[model samples]
Target: DYHLLGGGDSKEVYVGWNHVQQIEIAWNQIVYYEDDEKLFTEEATLLKSLNHERIIKCCHYWFDSESKILNTITELFSSGSLKKYIHNGVGVDLVSIKNWGRQILQGLCFLHSQSPKIIHRDIKCDNVFVASDGKQFGLAVCIMDGDFVKEKEPKCTPEFMAPMCLLEMVTGEYPYMKCSNQMHIFKKVYTGVKPVSLGNVKDYRVRDIIEKCILPMSVRPSAEELLKDPFFLYNGRSSTFETCAPVDNILTSRAMNIKHLYLV
Candidate 1:
């Protein structure tokens, strides 16, 4: 049996424990209230076809006719989502951040390079997961259904959305939010008005990368192109680790301390 981990939209996530191997696994269950069988089938097919180190692995899947529920078992990452990690204030070094950005871009490149090409409409920190050792990252969930792809309008968070997507949403459309409608947001984005938070970023390299990602869709660089950017060329080794004492000294320090006792 699996314990409920968390849930979102119409899906529930569970953590399963294997007594024999003493390991844990993650199961994503999507419950259908309506008779949308095609959606479930397509999602399953897409998940099964995807295989990448930076994308969560879907090992097995099954459907329960009685409950109208679809379940998929995938690898369980211990650190959970990247959004939570950043909010917790652990303070990741620049090297690790660059590595993470590179990994994410690699995953995106793989998806976009496919025959039909998969556009992850919802690419945000919340959907990115971290491994137990914190050395790896993976994209958690995606919407691969035909409706989202053909609709042309993006269904994603406003903050992470590119200006092109925002324009599409407000084109010949009325306001959605009261205080700030889609048009207002689109105007700000289209006119080159950046978010206040962006100015707070001290690193020009990081800021430039972020700016490139939000450019008009017509000019926005593809994932493969961005992978070759100079920003990702920085060696991921931290100066702090490089300046650490030699491995032999670190391993033999305790033995050397006890040597004086024996000599006395």
Candidate 2:
């Protein structure tokens, strides 16, 4: 019901790609069916006012008191969510996942940077959509399911829960002692120091930012904070995202040169 409007329930996506040109979403929850239509119209109108690449752009909306229905439309993405792709024997690889992680952060950064600010509380693989060519290897994660997103105090998910969650759960003391929800986890992670339980992502850049994003706020990382992140580096026959690929010999040369330079 909620997902289809703009981002229909995760299960509803792809039910009928051709049936609708754009999906509508409500800015707030609808407790009454009578108000559902109006909610979609109003929220869609608001979202349409903003612009960003990763966000599923809202198109238009209208109120139909006669039919007791509200209408809103948005860009139609034929490709489905990353969750859908993962369900069909295509688990996101390290490279693609890293790119996705980067893009998700980018989208969040864009929203959080807004004058008022917007936060996608439910950030997960299922909520993220892929382009129609989602299978095309190299596209970053596309954020969808904005209906559940909020501009103020946000709702947070437990899974994909940031590290501070684990830390607070484990340590359970001041600072994070009262922490709850995943965003708190992210806030703690933004500090730069690693949260105890997390492991490293394969991509150096991604891993670094994840650590940065989760870094405690005292040392928060910004979107402009650049690391040596690779876009698409290839070596031999297999791409980096590929499961099997040859290692580059040049790394040894570079390492040796650095060693000599340091010694001097």
RMSD of candidate 1 to true structure, Å: 16.6
Summarize candidate 1's per-residue lDDT along 158-229 as a digit string, tens digits.
444552211111111111222266566656655766664454445556667767877766788877887798
Name the top TM-score candidate: 1
Which residue ranges in model 2 land beyond 4 Å of their true spot? Answer: 1-42, 64-70, 135-154, 158-207, 226-264
Model 1 lDDT vs. the true structure? 0.57
Residues 1-264, candidate 2, lDDT per residue (tens digit)?
334333233212212232353443323221224544544444455566767787766555454566543443445445655544554555334555445555655666666566544433334444456676763321122222222323332333432334221112112111232357657655653454344434323445434444554543446444434222343232213224222111112110000110011100
Report how far off residue 244 is in candidate 2 (Å): 18
TM-score of each: 0.74, 0.50
Off by over 4 Å in 1: 18-22, 143-149, 163-192, 236-264
What are the clashing pairs of model 1? none
